[model samples]
Target: MILIEDTVISDDVADKFFVCNLEKCKGACCVEGDLGAPLEASELPVLDEIFPKIKPYLTPEGIKAIEEKGCYEQDWEGDYVTPTIEGRECAYALYDERGVLKCGIEQAYNDGVVDFKKPISCHLYPIRITKYEHYHALNYDRWHICSPACDLGKNLGVPVYKFLKDPLIRAFGDDWYKQLEREIEEK
Candidate 1:
């Protein structure tokens, strides 16, 4: 493990390779999960604030799910998460013209309709953060659906930390990410 500040990052984060191949997986990460995307406590109010802006980018089913279930809900574990469509796909997910599921909130952000991007959890995908009382543990999430991403990353010679630079920086600041890079290099 590599430690920086209050976070402990798994070695897999530096050793593993990944880059999302959306064409191959078709965003199955958003649909195949047992629950919707995890949400931070601070994000609940943001969801409520941005739901209206993102609604137009969502499908009727997604909109209905969000409207009925509220923008976010508590999972079985009582952790906050985006609501799913009939407990299937995430309620914020919509299909692009090519049939790949994408985040409506992200589309809205892309269009300058909302200031907030999608949830930090969704942004930092394949890296799930577990919060403990004292610190946060970051681990690489290996899912079968991400095989294409693994293959592509291997072909492209990009490590998980390199591939997820932007999101990592977004999650833990540029200075922290730099420290992680330096630590991995020293390893």
Candidate 2:
């Protein structure tokens, strides 16, 4: 583990390679999970505030789920998460013309309908964070559905940290990411 600031980062985050192969995986991570995308407490109000703007990008099913279940729901562990469509795909997920699942919130953000670009947890996927009282544990999440991504990342010579630079910066700030990069380089 590497410690920087208040985060304990897994070695796999630096050693393992992963870049999302969306065409191959078809965004299975958003669908195969038992619950919806994990959300931070601060994001709850953002979802509520932006629902109106992102609604147009969402599918009817997703809209129904969100309307029925509210903007977010509590998981079995009592963590806040986006509601899912009948406990399947995230309610904020929509299938594109190619049948690949996409994030509706991100779509809206791309179109300038909203400023927030989806949940931080969703943005920093393959890197799940567990917040404790003193620190946050950042770990690489290995899933069968992401085999293509792993293979591609290996071929492209991209480690998990590099592949997720933008989100890491978004989550922990640029200085923290620079510190992480320096630590990885010294190793």
Candidate 3:
């Protein structure tokens, strides 16, 4: 494990390589999870506030799910998450012409309808964060659906941490990401 400030990061992040192969996986991560994208407490209001802006980009089923279940729901684990369409794709997911799942929230953000991108959890995929009383534990989530990504990453020689630099900085801040880089370099 590598320690940076209050977070303990698993070495797999540096050892493994990954870059989402959306063409191959078709964004299965958005559709195959047991639950919708995880949400932080602070993100609830943001979801509520941005739903209207993102709604236009959603499918009818997605809009219906959100309309009936609200923007988010609490799972059996008592953790908040985005709503799903019939326990399938995330309510915020939209498919492109090729049927690849894309984030409606991200589309809206790119269109300048909202400032917030998708959830930090979704943005930082393959990296799951668990918060303990004293520190946050960061681990790489290995999923078979992402095998193409693993192949691509290895071919390109991009470590998981390096591939995820932008979202890591977004989640942990520039200083924290810089410290993480330094620590990895020293390794």
Which number leads on lDDT?
Answer: 2
Pairs with backbone N, CA or C atoms under 3 Å apart (clashes), candidate 1: none
**Across residues 48-132, which tens digit of lDDT does each residue of candidate 3 receive?**
9989888899999999999999999999989999999999999999999999999999999999999999999999999999999
In model 2, what are the clashing residue pairs, if there are any? Answer: none
Sliding window of 10 residues with minimal summed lDDT for model 3: 48-57
Question: On a 0 to 1 TM-score scale, where does candidate 3 land against the true structure?
Answer: 0.99
List clashing residue pairs in candidate 3: none
| Clashes within 3 Å, all models in order | 0, 0, 0
- Candidate 2 scores a C-alpha RMSD against the true structure in Å of 0.6
Q: What count of clashes does model 2 give?
A: 0
| 55-75: candidate 2 lDDT, tens digit per residue | 999999999999999999998
Stretches off by above 4 angstroms in model 3 are none
lDDT of each candidate versus the true structure: 0.94, 0.96, 0.95
100-181 in candidate 1: lDDT tens per residue? 9999999999989999989999999899999999999999999999999999999999999999899999988999999999
